[model samples]
Target: MDRLGDTYRWKSENVSTAEVAETLGHFSGIHEANVYGVQVPGHEGRAGCAALSLDDGARKDFDWKGLAAFAYQKLPRYAVPVFVRVLGTEVGSAASHNNKQDKVKFGAEGIDPGMKGKKVVGGEGDEVWWIPPKGIGM
Candidate 1:
């Protein structure tokens, strides 16, 4: 693990979650972002996932397609988050007591709807967006 222990392996590439989060934070309407890795069934390594908090009143106007494009341009193919979780307004939902984003629970939750609960994100109406892997069907 690196200094932040935010590094993970995906597609035989070492991905730095902080780097991906920083790239995501640069996007408009994003207030804060946290990147982590989630296990994909039958996959060799963990897959990238990001949990983001948008600026006030930015949710309805957020452009997912545009974000995808921005990510593709700024990040490497393997570093781009495969799943995005739009978190709620509550601060505790995305941050911990020390004000640092926590990834333990989020990583465990992954992108599976069935794994989601009151503790995990992706509740009713909470947008969990996903981008298919390269050359894969939508």
Candidate 2:
């Protein structure tokens, strides 16, 4: 079974995916947001990750740092997503049979970049964005 459910532990804190998703949904350009936790090698617990579906015309104008800043204001530091997966479309890329996000699949994929990640979705639009510790300056 998938270790990650509605919540996951990170840095001795249990983060609520629903809360983070709600925070992300309010962002300007995101049409939808799927939040989950991925087990990071060498870490005691999982790290938060979000798979985003962008709104029309927002893809070209998406601001990464802006998103980071927005998240910083809206969420707790431990609750903020450490990784982001920009899904290709809002329709069928990562949806489950019930038309919701397939967290099981995303959880399995984790945060591997390069060819490994590309192989999971089989699409060129799946871009992985990382927020290294204190990398965003905000």
After the best TM-score superposition of candidate 1, give how far the Cα of residue 131 lies from its true spot, in angstroms: 2.0
Q: Per-residue CA lDDT of candidate 2, range 6-123, in tens?
A: 8889999999988999899999999999898998899999999998899988999898888898888888889989999888766246677677667767788787764434334653
| Candidate 1: regions farther than 4 A off | 1-5, 90-92, 121-125, 133-138
* Structure candidate 1, residue pairs in collision: none
Residue 4 displacement in candidate 1 (angstroms): 6.8
lDDT of 1: 0.79
Task: Kindly list the per-residue Cα lDDT of model 1 for residues 1-138, writing each as its tens digit.
Answer: 364438889999999988999999999999888888998899988989888889999988988777888888899999999998787754246566677777777777778877665555434445678876654542
Q: How many angstroms is residue 44 displaced in model 2 relative to the true structure, after the best TM-score fit?
A: 1.1
- Give the number of the best model, judged by lDDT: 2
